[model samples]
Target: MSETILLVGHGSRAANGNREIEQFVQSWRERQPAWRIEVCFIEFAEPLLDAGLTRAAQDARRVIVVPLILNAAGHAKMEIPAHIAAARLRHPATEFVYARHLGAVEPVLHILERTLRRAMLALDAPDPKTTGVILLGRGSSDRVANGEVAKMARWLHEETSHELVDIAFTGITHPRLETVVQRHSRIGMTQVVVLPYYLFTGTLIERIQRQIAHLRQQYPLLRFGLGGHFGFEEEIFGLLDERVRAARADGTARAEHMMECDGCKYRGLAEPHESHHHDHAHTHAREVPA
Candidate 1:
């Protein structure tokens, strides 16, 4: 059957971030020429979800909606599915499959380790066993989603040489970067690294850099460093292809590695309810990236 892949990105206010997503999509398109891939944003960028879906479903027998998000947060749970449901009604003949998010899987952990090591090398940091590492995520109100980040922190500690590894959020949660930094400082950890658990640069990433700058001033005795985000990596591309394959097989994006939707409060509710508009205000200060 003819298929179209509608890659949905969690939009950002930063033009460069959106451009990165677009460029990523373009690369995927070139890499897999057989699949008719289309890119769209949930907000803050052109070609919003509905419009992009409309364009993608025009001449395909089946359309797979793959969320280019890190975690299955609010946007993946409620917002994107709602739009996909709407697209289903608008195009009854086309099959719409909702794929899973780019989850906290083993491959992602590998990429993060590489990012951390590179950052540490650049800083000429001390032994990983002694140095403190903080995994900074774009925080979410969904406790389940937030737990995934915490899980990654534990996994990183287990997989790496770092003995002191912690997890913190950029916004909308406790144990923010500053809080973790303060705790690390109190513990007398001389060298600390903050790894931004993100795929692209966004407002929150910028805010994190600013926060790190301020932290450097606050803790003059301690050495602080910011690591790179999860940019375009082969592992990430492999995961994206995995999602597409899962969607093609079962049409529900079901995979053993991906998070179960049963934990989501918004699961199985795809109607465009009034509450959809009230779906979390993803503003500059309130938003959390995938």
Candidate 2:
């Protein structure tokens, strides 16, 4: 039986952003040339998810749709599966597998913590332990997804020596960066570190930088620093490869740990929805080297 890998990215309007994902997939192909690999986007880029699935089913018996997202947000839960269900209709003979979203897993946590320590060292901060850290994410309307970020904050606090770790969003959620900055400053945290929990640069990161800049200007007494983003580095490929392997074993993209629901948020149900849009509105605000 022939095997195939479908790298589904959250398509961005910016060609560069789309290109970044393509390059990432290209690297994967280089490492493992045996499997037939295909890349597609959910929106804002050519070779959309439906098209990718159609193409993958042409020759392979098992097609693994690895969603290139950070959290178990709307896209992962709703949109990706909806597309898969549609593809199954077109090619009922083909088998489609879904995998889990790339959250703050153990490997990522290690990278994130290392990045924070580097940022603080670059700033020549007096006490890295006392500095407050903020894990900033593309805030989701789904409470479950938002809760994931909050949970990551607690994990980071335990994994690192930061005095206080917090969660903030770029949009569509409470406790935005500004609100947190004020609360932390008033509470007498001399230094604050904001880590952008993202794989690629987008408008949300730009918005975060601007918000942090303004906060720095407002509170000159306190130090504000931004950490490096989680780009399409070597570790990203490792994580996706692991997911693809798991999908191959389970015969589906839906992972065991992910919440189970169909025709819910990703497909836009009236009630009990689990996803929100913004996958395609990825404007270039930050750039990570390929």
Candidate 3:
């Protein structure tokens, strides 16, 4: 039976950011040539998610929509599924399954480590003991999503001996990227590593560069290193492949590596108004289904 893998990304207004997603998709096509692959966006870009789903349904018997999202906020939890649910009605004969977001995978913890390590290495291998860490996430109005980033920062702190690890948001929530990066720089730490907990780069990353630029001027002596986003990594592909297999086997929107609901403070914690947060595009991958 013909099958297609529809990779969905949050669309971006930035041309370069959108291009990177295409490049990412290209890599998948190069790696696996047997399966049909398609790319789509949720907003602000061409070939929106619905279009991709419709196109995939036309030629493939089985269609799997994999969201390249880094966090499980409204987009992942509510929007994407809503889109899939609607698409299912139009393509009732097509077998459709949705896979988990990237952050759900535990191995991504290592991706975070690796991202920070690169920044550390670039800064002359600063002693982890003396280095302060700031992990930036594309923040959400949903406190639950924001909390996941905090959890990641905590995990990073445990994995390494970094005495200070803080989480900051690029858009919403408390302690913006600038506030955390600047505060950490002024502290006693010899170095500060600003790492992004993102699937790929986008407008927000450019915004981060502005923050890094300003920090560089204020504290020239402090080793301020910025790390790249997780892009085209082998582990990423492996995890996505695993999700595809799991979803295909079960023929359901398999929420693999889903966050545990118990012990989740954000589930019941009071949060600010949801209107405070904004959204942006992120994601990548290319391939033909195997």
Candidate 4:
């Protein structure tokens, strides 16, 4: 049986956000026509997790969910797992595996580097030795998650000859956008362009734009511009494909594996049964007809 991949993303209210993801999935489908590829949103969008799972289970034995999120935070840690559990309950026979969020992956850094280079070319900004880059990301409460972005910043600084490079957040943690911009401005940097390490435009991007506007007024001599978000990048799809294949190989393929309740009353029967255990207590059990 063919395995299915569900490219799950933190859905946005902005139509462009959804459009980008859909376009990426379409591009992925074109590369591998035999495998099933579906896109679903964690929240604030249609064809949600449950619906996506149902659709995937139709012909697939296993479903791999790859979160497009940048970090392992509220959505990746709590909400996504809860939804996956709910889907498992409804379709116990299907195999489901959750892949890690796109956290500080090499391809991601390449995408950022390309975007930054393009932005500089468009504005005729000076070489990296003279210009500065601000690596911006949506902050997270998870320290590990925050550290991942910081590591990316350090990598960018070391890889490029930018006079100044720093990581800042749009929300959730310190070294906020405004603070980063002002600090660099004081150093007599002629051009400071903000590169958003985000996949789509949302409230965070809008907030960044407003911050950039305010900074422009405060420092009229400084030149600033916003780079495009990561969108329809081929490298992204290649990484996603690798993730899906890994999930399938890791014994998480859904359709090919089946779990049997040996103690259930319907164990000997052909009908489906639902079993629930409370608080990880293996002894306690309740069965319901399915």
Per-model root-mean-square deviation over C-alphas = 4.3, 5.7, 7.0, 9.7
Provide the TM-score for each candidate, comma-separated: 0.90, 0.85, 0.85, 0.82
Highest-scoring model, TM-score:
1
lDDT of each: 0.81, 0.74, 0.74, 0.70
lDDT of 4 by residue, 250-279 (tens): 654331122223333223333235222111
Q: How many clashing residue pairs are found in candidate 2?
A: 9
Enumerate clash totals for all models, in the order shown. Answer: 0, 9, 9, 5
- lDDT at 2, model 2: 82
Flag the better candidate by TM-score, 3 or 4: 3
Worst 10-residue lDDT window for candidate 4 reads 281-290
lDDT string, candidate 1, 28-98, tens digits = 98889888999999999989999999999988988888888887767776677668778878999999888
For candidate 1, the TM-score is 0.90
Write candidate 3's Cα lDDT for 89-147 as tens digits: 99889887777666645788888888888888898897998899998888776666677
Between which residue pairs do clashes occur in model 3?
Answer: 10-281, 25-285, 25-286, 28-286, 29-286, 29-287, 35-288, 35-289, 36-289
Model 1 deviation from the true structure expressed as Cα RMSD, one decimal place: 4.3
Q: In terms of lDDT, which candidate is strongest?
A: 1
TM-score of 4: 0.82
Report clash pairs, candidate 2: 74-275, 78-266, 79-266, 97-252, 97-253, 98-252, 98-253, 98-254, 99-253
